[model samples]
Target: MMGGKGNSVFSLSPNPNHLCISMEDGSQSSEQLVVDDDDDDLPPIDDTPDLDIDLEEEEEEETRRDEKCFMAPPAPGMEFDSYDDAYSFYNSYARALGFAIRVKSSWTKRNSKEKRGAVLCCNCQGFKLLKDASSRRKDTRTGCQAMIRLRLIQFDRWKVDQVYLHHNHSFDPHRAHKKSSSAATKTTLPQPPLHVQVRTIRLYRTLSLHTPPTHPLFQSSRRLELRGGFRALQDFFFQIQLTSPNFLYLMDLADDGCLRNVFWIDARARAAYSHFGDLLLFDTTCLSNAYDLPLVAFVGINHHGDTILLGCGLVADQSFDTYVWLFRAWLTCMLGRPPQTFITQQCKAMRTAVSEVFPRAHHRLSLTHVLHNIFHSVVQLQDSDLFRMALNRVVYGCLKVEEFEIAWEEMIIRFGLTNNETIQHMFQDRELWAPVYLKDTFLAGALTFPLGNVAAPFIFSGYVHENTSLREFLEGYESFLDQKYTREALCDSESLKSIPELKTTHPYESQMAKVFTMQIFRRFQDEVSAMSSCFGVTQVHSNGSASSYVVKEREGEKVRDFEVIYETSAAAQVRCFCVCGGFSFNGYQCRHVLLLLSHNGLQEVPPQYILQRWRKDVKRLYVAEFGSGRVDIMNPDQWYEHLHRRAMQVVEQGMRSKEHCRAAWEAFKECANKVQFVTEKPS
Candidate 1:
């Protein structure tokens, strides 16, 4: 049917049952045309066999395309028109690279229809379930960190702000090709160069083209250098997964297969972050574990004005790269939500890493760390009480920005620190530590390092401390989560069942008790109670509907004056602002603001002033039965497994005491009755 110049030429393939034949005319041109070879003498092929052959070729072609995709991966700053468009682009890249992606998480504003951002991730990004696996099929998920994050910039434009294309597992392009290549014939076909095959094999084995030898991640090295307590820690994590699949952890394996770094978070922490993730306090000075790894705690403030654990990381070293890796892991686990404010100690590596990783976040130095720096950097300032006093005044006692600047200049001049590099650097970064310069920045409840200054009420403080074993830390971490979530459950029960007695006869007080969490309501109650002490109000000025006044409050023997401003807008709308910035910092009104409200004859608290994060009745997607964020809500299998896990949790909790057991029994019976009635009803 075809000829090349003179003799009939057939395209050579290892498989003689190939469908297409290559042909060329007698012309001098070198192009060959492919066509179906309909040999009249050939025997008929069965439909099923032909389908099988076509499928075999199709699979082989797919495998080849997948291998080729490794050469190209998405980079950060890639832009798209919509969240779906960004997701589709990343999903195609994942498919082409022989992996799967899923919606890790996405967030929309409270009353908005469109999403603010979304985190699409590798399907295998988190840990695989360590539950009973005898009846389950093999899963390919090995906690791969490969993912792409999409952030909505503005007006329907989404940008790929973060991209991670490294997979911890290997993909074999030889799967289909090796199977098809078995169909041999007495014919020689072309093959790629030997160097190319070797290069690909090395790539498959190492996956370390950009990785340094010391931190050879996902390398196929059998030699392991796992240090003290790491094995026990790994076993402990495995045991945790056995109990609940809600815990996620990531660890680095060196070129020699050493486990030196790890990060972990649980379902409760993820759900808490969804609500209270605006301000983050990242601290690492708490512990030096058995392996000498620095334990970093990701902390957030709850509605209770208490520090809660968001995640924890044990790094290999204090390098900027290591912290960057830890930050990226935590961000990915939290669905790529960057905090509005980030607080940490003033370590150069940490500061640089925070700035680079969370570019949009306001990185503030811990007040205690700032003091420590001042003491160490200016050793002579400690010799004279006058010098130290002046420095403290500049750092802490300033009430206004102008006052702070004047105090700082006077302190530097009085101490003769004009040539000191540390003082100059501190002056350059004054906005990072000085509270006078940062009154506008919201800090939630974190004004300084939680562990350094305040009594750390977190359960971890009781269970974890310096020089602890990795296993001890993990065990304590798990125990604390169990207790913390139990506390939340108890508080939820109290909020739903009981209301606090009103300290004030105001209708606003009654509404607050119902709207706020019990702890937050108590904080509000304190402000209302203190309104009695706030007197001697004098109008400073008035313009349009707005009025500014000075209010004096008595605290002990000292009477402090505060600047308060209010606007009586149309429709009974009242706005209050205080120079104290109590609502801005603590998400609650100050006594001064409350006094202004009473003066304006406004009975109820402003609806706009009530923060949604402090609301008691809001439901969250991650808090569905207090479940993890890793579960794909759209997947029936994941939902069934999650529900089953929740049922098991009830069984475990009910075993704790007789009261819990009885209550759980009654609840289970009632639920079963409803399910049975539904099944019995006509469909």
Candidate 2:
């Protein structure tokens, strides 16, 4: 076994009988010797008591040192001794750690009576560590560290921040081993790990008392569950929904958790909401009632005949052009076709619009309108009873062209209206309108009946007769009224006293009868003039030539004197030059030939004139030929019957025999070819 020194420095020899010894400082040489038998039998010594005593002394020394370090009293406003002191220190320390702290007065203790009560616990304030820091700042003392925990509490409650101090102690190699003391310097501590639990603060504030939260006006359920801080409420009112007057009312009831000013709602938002169907109805009446201008309403009728409001727009000043485009677009959408028949008052604009959009459709002037215009014009002319009778004779009843001519002449003579240019123009286009009156159905009798006298002037310019029994009876009845109520007696009546003086007739008791008779004739002349002048005739030549003709008044009636000269070789080429200027000045030719022939050239009519005078259908003569060397001895009806029977026999024979069928087929093909050839030939 080695001595203590040798054993501590190196391992002993494994021989139990050998002994090795070395000096502690290694100055002496190591020596090895045989072990004594007597030493081997000696017992092992126990050193447990000695070791326990040494450890007890060491612990005692450490306890004394710790007590000495903690003995110093904390400075004012500093906490060092107790947990309360530590908590107070922590309150400021946590704020320095970037944790926002809120203190409540009552939160410090749970019971009012208890002085050493447990600190009311709550969530700690949170802080985030900076990404980069200097080495000095990042030192153990300088780094971020949690010093306190903040607790949230209800109003009127106290708040507290708890803190813990962290200290650093280590031996330095450079310092001498001596008993010494240095004043401690305060240093920033490292930040603690962030708290895992986070609590969001919510607040409520009353915006307005008038628009309360519980008010029925704030009926939108969507407005109730909004969540956010004061800033969020601001965004909701101003940025999101926009605070209109309506919305402002709703906002007034909102209790803001995070108090913030409400935002204004713009006019744009009001306009937007106003148009959402049932939300608000806009008033556009001002646009409609601005002027006395005429507006055409375009209404669309569905297949069910229900009208749909299409649109309303300003009417153009030029009515005709505007209506043309408007009605064209309207009809296209409604009926899928332009209107074929248009009935309207005698408005020039309406007429033009009809011609532009529905040229092919028949356009009829309202009889009521025509009559009204005629009545006004008739009031301007003054005539007598004969003229009145002649005018009535032509208007109320349908008569032949010759009768119309005779009545017209008589009316002009009686009225002294023969030299009136306006009256002459009225008769200028009689041919074009004569068909309308002669065929009563043309106007559905609206222009010819009970209101004949009233509607005549407006409808046509022509003669009317008073020969009917009804007219005669009315005349007798009127005479009886005149006898029973003389002018003086009529003037004295209370009903007549209030009546305004007649425009055309003076209130002369002596001339009342004459004025009444003159009024009738004036009305008759007006009707005749209006109807005759309504249309102007333009002659259309076969070769595409056109010319306008106006009726000329000779004395007081329209008259035409013209001679038609034909080429001897080409009688078809005829020229007509009327002393009335043909269609150049007036719209139509007058009948001077009838006057001349009836008065001076009777039974000596020219051949060319006779041919021209024939009716349109009678002027043409057809010559028929059967075939080469075959006379056309067949009567049209008999030949047609024979052809039909032959066709039936041919069909029967074709079905019975194949030879006949083949022959029939050949004949049919020949007939088809012949027909094709004929169709291809020039006229």
TM-score of each: 0.58, 0.21
Error of 1 at 503 (Å): 5.7
In the range 328-426, model 2's lDDT, one tens digit per residue, is 433322223443334444544555556666676555544434434444445556554444455555643333456677777776776666786545644
Note the Cα lDDT for every prediction shown: 0.59, 0.29
Highest TM-score: which candidate?
Answer: 1
By how many angstroms RMSD does model 1 differ from the true structure?
Answer: 17.2
- Where is model 2 more than 4 Å wrong at Cα? 1-319, 336-340, 347-352, 384-390, 419-683
Q: Which residue pairs overlap in candidate 1's backbone? A: none
lDDT of 2 at 289: 32
lDDT of 1: 0.59
Clashes of each: 0, 50
Error of 2 at 386 (Å): 7.0
